[model samples]
Target chain A: MEILKKLKILADSAKYDVSCSSSGSKRTNQPGGLGNSASSGICHTWTADGRCISLLKILQSNNCVYNCSYCVNRVSNDLPRATLTPDELCELTINFYRRNYIEGLFLSTAIYSSPDHTMEMLLQTVKKLREEHNFHGYIHLKAIPGADNLLIEAAGKYVDRMSVNIELPSERGLRLLAPQKKREAIIKPMTFLTSNIAARKAERRKSRKAPSFVPAGQTTQLIVGATPDPDLQILKLSENMYKRFGLKRVYYSAYVPVSHHPHLPDISSPPLLREHRIYQADWLLRFYGFQADELLNEKNPNFTEDYDPKTDWALRNLDYFPVEINRADYEKLLRVPGIGVKSARKILTARRMHSLDFDDLKRIGITMKRAQYFITCKGKYSGQTAMEEHLLRPRLTLSPPKTAGPEQPSLFSFSSDVIAPEDAFSSVTGEI
Target chain B: MLDFVYDGSFNGLLTAIYEIYYRRQVPQQLLSSPGQTPKLFVREERIITDETKAGKVYEAIDTKISSRSLRHIYYAYLSEHMEAGIWIYHYLHLGWKLGNKLDLLLSDERVHRIHRLSQKVSMERHRLLGLLRFQLLRGNIYYAALEPDHNVVELLAPHFAARMAGQNWVIHDVSRDLAAVFNRKEWVATDFTLQHRLELLKEEEYYQQLWQEYYNSMAISSRINPRLQKRCMPQRYWKHLVELS
Candidate 1:
């Protein structure tokens, strides 16, 4: 078949994978290669639906042998399936790279024929690019769930980044949604990679000659809202993956309704806002010094629809706020609802030069409206008189609608009505 | 009042600043090029740059201000600020009064403008490090060119050297008529009166054809949005962008 005709069918089928990030790989040009891979950063270009199409985001083939209920590319779907030869894909990548159309390639595929068959084709494609074609640009390859360890390791050596989509949070969910896939198939490759990373590090420690192994590290994506898994369960799983596997990232994709299955919920699509909230919470867990337990529990299993995860946290832990601006440690300063890393650093830096006051906080660009309830500037409060949820909840919810723009009075007018930057700090729990 | 005329380089500006301050004479009119006349009734005295006088001025400013501040002053001079040369003189005067807190003057809108201008120049330097695309010509020489809005060509030198270490490459700022040439080991700037002899590559046309083919191949006709593409890659920049061009 013609390359363009085959590519369209394959890419269209591959679109539902929802793991198009080309970030977190850091490889540079070698002697014979024409390009390099940047670390954890891809020039992400998104479509109108906010789909990342920056890379040649495509599947090598869509001729699946396994029938997964949730997947549109399942064997039952009788779609116009096609596969590209390794040389065809390599030629296309070089052509595209020279034109500056893409930073790199994000290649994934369905289990065409078998897991080994799919992975072998992917391995050949990447191997040809690195060895024969001398194509040095970024490559993010997908590790087929049940692929052989040798094939998986071989795939890692050629590409900058790799991922094996968790597909579902739990094994129960996996069985119900994707019957052919197993928990061991997904976890084994991850465990092998985790051990491989350890072995590579040890090799490096013993001798300086050891080559880099998946320099960007492995990442996985879990389909949120697919199973009966709560956000708490998801976060717990995410936290464990970070601690256990040393995974670089755990991308959470809110499920998009792609099929009309009898068992699957008839929800149109997973709420985009919920997906956005999960990402916010995910960032809090990763960057902000918050643990999954700290953000959620049995009582607060899901993120609040109205307020962001951080704000939600700050409001629940109201007593922790009113943190002293000049005295608070970096971690404590970070916990303040409104204070971001940039602002916290500014506060720390500016305090060294001069003793900070309420006016000084404003000058340094702290969004006092949120921070006032949580922090104090020179023993003064600049937030609301009522830190109680009844008064604060309405004010917080009303604030977004009331003063969302330039037409409204300045949001800063609450300084006298409140007290100091301290009083503003604890007013809300803004995590994300 | 003394009027001093010097070359337009950063060192020339510093040497002129040194002359005025140490000589204990304020120039009513300072011109970069010779033969410029100031308004009538303003006394103009030309001060020739002397090594001793310049050194004393440099030492005093270095002691009063800071080495970091001095670098900022140099950056401001290179910024080609509209009234930057004159502003530097005023800033030095402010520093003399303000002691170590000379940066307090940075709060002023005029000084802020200089800082903003310098930041703009610095930001372009950072972005170009990742954004620059190099193409290999027929002669085995790599030619990468840019038209950045800031004077970031110098800042881009160190990064490209480390990244493209073994290769012979020419990074040319087309608008500035300056090129940073990395020949095997050493890198240096060249301002050629005649254009560079680097042969135009047939590789470009090859890449261009491939890129156009890829662009057509990737674009979903079912989900075409020229408006979104235009938003991400503006029409103004399309002529130089290898994909669009």
Candidate 2:
């Protein structure tokens, strides 16, 4: 197949990096503009793996100069290589946009020659999309770490969200696994983006018409279970990243063993449960007002497979439990097991009208199965057993099998109960 | 049990609700025209779809309850659930006294039922926003065909009209025989039919092929979870999706 026609080859190469979130930017369609970005983002489809196909996530080119060992399109690898021209990229994005196949384009690339050339190619394609095609859709362009700051800066203006992947958590993992990729090379571009994104916001504050730069801010991804790096190390790194730089999200992809390198762990399947736990912890940090240290400490560096990060935190600190549902503030409600941001808000709202009971809690959409142990409605506990770590630990551990199992996922399909509650935000009304 | 029949138009539904109030009769079922006949001996009345009465009820919901409640009632009505009319009646009956607080009483079965049906309809609307696939017709019209759970094709028009302001498009909800046809200036929802399978442009096929190839290659084989995929985009929606075929 011609290099330009090998859409599958480039897409397969680009599929592993999982940062498809298209939210944060609200670029309205200009008069006669071909597209616009929704503030919350619209997920167009779900791929077979169940991951959302929100954007046309593709690479500009897969022929690489640097050989990252974990990557499918490394220099030494013999995979089919292809490059989409700037016009080809625009055409595909516009055609897809017209058909509602995607929210926007998620353009990344392997270092085809130098980082500068590759970044320029990405920048060129996005600029053409905006200028020639009059497209205003969400664009998430990946920043090449070692690329020049000018190219990165130029790319930011045309894109909604930009990301630089810190694939390995620790510098030591970076040294061992990817010899060519220095930790400083990645950090330098990230720091630049962090400052520039901030400066542009300050400018927009002064003048609303000042053109937005990376309106959705920036994001980064870390490969989990790639090395012997503990979950503590991963969480700590994410904590520092969020605090130090105002990044939007830090995605954790369970390292799929693409090749058998001596440095890589000989795991049969990706550690999806660990990834899910880390994501749960990450959510707590971002939305639920929890710190990394609160969830994990040095004494227990790794998350146990027995419980989720929140449940583990609740169990370790039982003193915070038995919070009175009616009187407990929003923060206290959040700390309780199984009370998510939505449910916590629900409890607060329902509490105003009348004091809640266990029955009311259930109606308010609280996950009573897990929450029954931690909370008291009308000062009455509803757990099957008393509120002790030994008693609750057995009950709290997830009974439902992981969505992505350790072995081939098809062997033990998850029951409906496990799947139903997901992203349901099923907490029904209380606009009251 | 009292049964109310009317045209399956939103205005007609509102007119039924208006009659329910003026006649001081509680209805057990609200059936749309050409709808199923009521069982033997059930009191049935066909309501005339009066824009004037509907306008009055629409204004009353906004003034008495909040505009938010108006949205809830409208969305619940669109759900076309069998008992939605009765629930809305119960909701409005209590809402007259409780006003805005009616929704806040989440524990109330009537209020909760209205919210739940509305949620189901809106969720499907959000899904179809992402799932509706537009193909280019031979006449340069961007055409899409879908069978949404609720009548959301009209709802989806403003978004597409803003995004694709330069182009003419038609979003046809095949199940209901309704289509949202948009010219550059404005859009209208009207009765439409396909007559036959749409003749798409040859380039439209090429783009769909490219999209299919891209979609297929995007999934990581190591983490393939058909169950999750099905949950998010169920099998019922796969009929119109080009990538699925």
Candidate 3:
């Protein structure tokens, strides 16, 4: 087949993977090298789906041996299959990089023939990009499950970031949908990569020139809504993964239906809003000092679609509200419904010079519409007359004001405006 | 009321600030050349840009404030806001008195305005670094043109220099008629006019087609959101973008 035809099939197959970050590793171009990875990732462009295309996300081959029900590349799908030669992949990456189309390559492969063979092909492509092409740009490689420990380790040294996708949340879901992939097959490589990365860090501390091992860190993805796994169970598993294996991110891809299976949810599209809420709760877990249990529990298995996870948490624990803005510490300031990490930091830095009032808070980038009920400035409250949940809940749940007209251009707006806090969290966590 | 006017340059702005301090007079406004209409009792003074005076003020600021704050000042200057000259003056005034604590003085209107202005310019510069596209032209020179809201050509040049070290490239700010030309080893800024139209390399069209194809194939059709795409990459940037065009 022609290279472009293969590219279309392979890239289309890989679109569902959804991890597009090319960040957290600061590798500068060597004397004769062609590219470099920035510490903060750059989004080259936004696709029509409103997703950032940061990397050339493509699969080496879309011909799989395993029958994962949720996947498009599963063995029984009967879609057009295509694989690129290692040389073809390298040429595409270099050409795209030269044209400023992408930051680097996000190379994944299906279980073509066997796991070891697929991984070896991936390793050869990445190694060739780094060594022969002198490409020093960001490369995110997949740590193929059930691949040999030595193969995973050797590949880790060449790439900036690596991930082993835990496709389903629970072991039962894995068995029901993807019977070939055992829980151990996924977790074992993650554990091996984590320990090897730790050892490499220790080695680098002793010697400045020691080669890095997965410097951007490992991330994983879980297909939500495919099986009957509740939000609480999924989040708990994610929390445990973060603690145990030191994963940088856990992406939740709302299960987009591809195959007509009696066992799977009979939905045409993924439950994006649910995926978005999980991401919001995930952010609270990572940065906002909230535990998985705090966000959702056994009683409340799913987050409400009406309000964001943070707002929901704040409303439930009203005793924590009426926080004194002037005297509250950074942690307390962060718990407010409307305030984000950036706004919270702004408040911290600004409060040192002078006490902040409601007007001052607006100027400092706080979302006053939601933050008003939760905060007090200089012992004064500017919230509604009644602080009851019934009254405040309706106010917090109101949609954002609409733009003047559809064609009225917003010159200064950014990607943050496109994705709300929860949506931003979902996209960033998925990509990063 | 005195209106201090200077050449429209960062050094000129700094010199005006120095004059404000030296003369011990608070000006009604600081105007970049092409001063506004003068009132009966208002004095308009044309202050020439002096590198020595600008250097002295910058050195003092570097000593008193953090280098990060200095960058903020530079970026704020690039914003070219109507009141940026006055805002920077007020920021430096506080920086001198409070030293490094001026960054935390966000409640102060002047300091907050400058901080926000700096952020706007810096964010644009950062965004353009990724959004900027280059078309390979004849003579092996890659050329790109953008009309950013702020003056960020100089800010973006060093980044491309390091990333595309061995290549020849030119980033043209069509709005300001300024171009940053990077030869194989080094780069310099030059005043450019669109006198001649250059043809793209034959292979450029083929690669652009492939990129557009890849871009279209990658998006999930079920989740198409043009509103969000517009917000992330504004329509203003779409003219030069290969895939969008």
Candidate 4:
């Protein structure tokens, strides 16, 4: 088959895995290297889905041996199969990098023939890209769940990032959908990679010449809405993963129903809003110092679809609010519904000069619409007549209707504009 | 009200700023040569671009303030905002007083304005690093043309130079009529204009088509949000975007 035909099949197959970040690594260009990975990832283009396309996300092959019900390339599914030679993949990456089409490659594959065979092919392609082609570009390779430990370790040296997808959140979910994939197969590699990365870091501290191991660290994706996993369960699992495995990111991909099975949810579309909310709660867990129980619990297992998780948390815990903005510490400021990491830092820096009022808060880039009810600037409340739950709840829940007209100039304006709470929510959370 | 006008260059702006401190008189407005317009009761002073005076101000900024502040000042100059020169003057004045702590005074209007303008310029430069698409021209030279809002071609050169170290490339800021040429070893900026269109390689056209095909195919049809897409990447940048074009 022609290369373009294979790319179409492979890329289309790989589109469901939405972990597109090329960040956290800073690989400089060698004297004769073709590319380098920036510490902060760059999005080369935005797809029609409004998601950033940063990497050449493609699979080595779509041929599968395992029967994962939620996947498009499961052995039971009769999709067209295609695999690229190691040389073909290298040439494609170099050509694309030269044309400035992508930052690097996101190479994934299904279980073709066997896990070891698939991983070896991936290692060969990445090894050739690094050694023969002299490509220093960001490469994100997928670690086959049941692949050899030595193979995974060797491949980790060449790629900037690697991920072993915990496709379903729970062991029960994995057993029901993907019977061949055991929970141990996934967690073992993550544990191994995490320990090895720590060892490499200690080695590098002793000697600067020690080569980096998975410089960007490992990230994993969890398929939301595929199983009957509650938001609380998922968040708890993620929280544990972060504590245990030292994962860089836990991407939440809204499960798109690609295959029809008796056990799977009979929905036509993915639960994108739920995925988005999970990402919001996930961000709070990662950056905003919020725990899983703080965001949601057994009684309230799901996040509200209207207001963000932060707003929901704030509304639930109203007594915490009316906190004096001037006197509040950084942690207290972060609890406000509208202030993010960036604005919180801005407020901290700006407040050192003078006491900040509501106007100054706006200038420092806080979303006053949501934060006003929760904060008092200089012992004065600028919110509505009463900070009652009924009034505030309705006001916060009402998502601003999409503005009609030629695109607003404010949309294209610089970063200092009063960030809409939803915009802040989406910026940190990956787009659908 | 006095107006100090100078040649439209970063050094010229610094020289005007130097004059403001030397003369012990604050100009109501600092204008670039092209921005200057005759007005009643406005005293206009044509400040020459003096490298020595500009160097003094630049070195003082590096000495008193941090090197990061110097970068912010240069970025703010590249922003080409109508009030950028005045803002930079005020920022430098404050920097001289507070030394390195001037950056911490984000609440000060002058400091905030300069910081915001510099942030805008830097953001655009970072965006162009990814958004700028190269088309393979004759002689295996990768060429890209863009019209960024800020004068960021020079800022973008080092990044591309590091990435494409073994390849020849030219990034043309068509609006400014300036090009950054990287010839496999070192990069140089020059005033360049296209006299004739060179025929692109056939493989280049084929690859561009393939890219468009991949881009269209990759998007999930159910979640097509044109508003969000426009917000992330404005239509102004679409003309030169190979897939969108």
DockQ of each candidate's interface versus the true one?
0.18, 0.60, 0.56, 0.55
Local accuracy by lDDT, each model = 0.68, 0.84, 0.85, 0.86
Residue-level lDDT tens digits of model 3 in A13-33:
999987888889999998977
How accurately is candidate 1 docked according to DockQ? 0.18
The whole-model C-alpha lDDT of candidate 1 against the native structure comes to 0.68
Residue A334 in model 2: lDDT: 85
- Which tens-of-lDDT digit does each residue in A1-432 have in candidate 1? 876677667767766665555566567677645666555454433343323355777788888888877777888886798888898898878756543456678888878777887889999999998899777778888988788999999888888778888878888888888887889888999999889978887897888677767766788998876677778888889898888999888877656666778756556435444555667777677767889999899997887655767778888888787799979988899888778777787687667656788877776557787777777878777775666766566555412323343433332121121122222112112232
i-RMS for every candidate (Å) is: 9.4, 3.1, 2.9, 4.0
What TM-score goes with each of the models?
Answer: 0.77, 0.95, 0.94, 0.94
For residue A236, what is the lDDT in candidate 3?
A: 96
Return whichever of 1 and 3 wins on lDDT: 3
Docking class of 4: medium
Ranking by lDDT: 4, 3, 2, 1
Candidate 3 residue lDDT tens string, B162-235: 88887899999999999999997999999987779879777888788788888989988766777767777888
Error of 2 at B218 (Å): 1.0
TM-score of 4: 0.94
Clashes of each: 38, 1, 0, 0
Candidate 4 lDDT, tens digit per residue, A306-356?
678898998889888788988999988888887878878888888887898
Per-residue alpha-carbon lDDT of candidate 2 for residues A1-432, written as tens digits (9 for 90 to 100): 653367888899889988887899899998878888988788999888788889999998899988777878889988888888999889888989999999999999988888888889999999999999899999999999889999999989999999999999988998888899898999999999999999999999999999899999999999988878889999999999999998999988888878888888777567666676678788888777899999888899887666777889999999888899889888888888778887887777777678888877777566777788888877788786888889888787665555664544432222222433352112111010
Candidate 4 regions with alpha-carbon error over 4 angstroms: A400-432, B35-38
True contacts kept of each: 0.06, 0.80, 0.66, 0.66
What is the TM-score of model 2 when looking only at chain B?
0.96
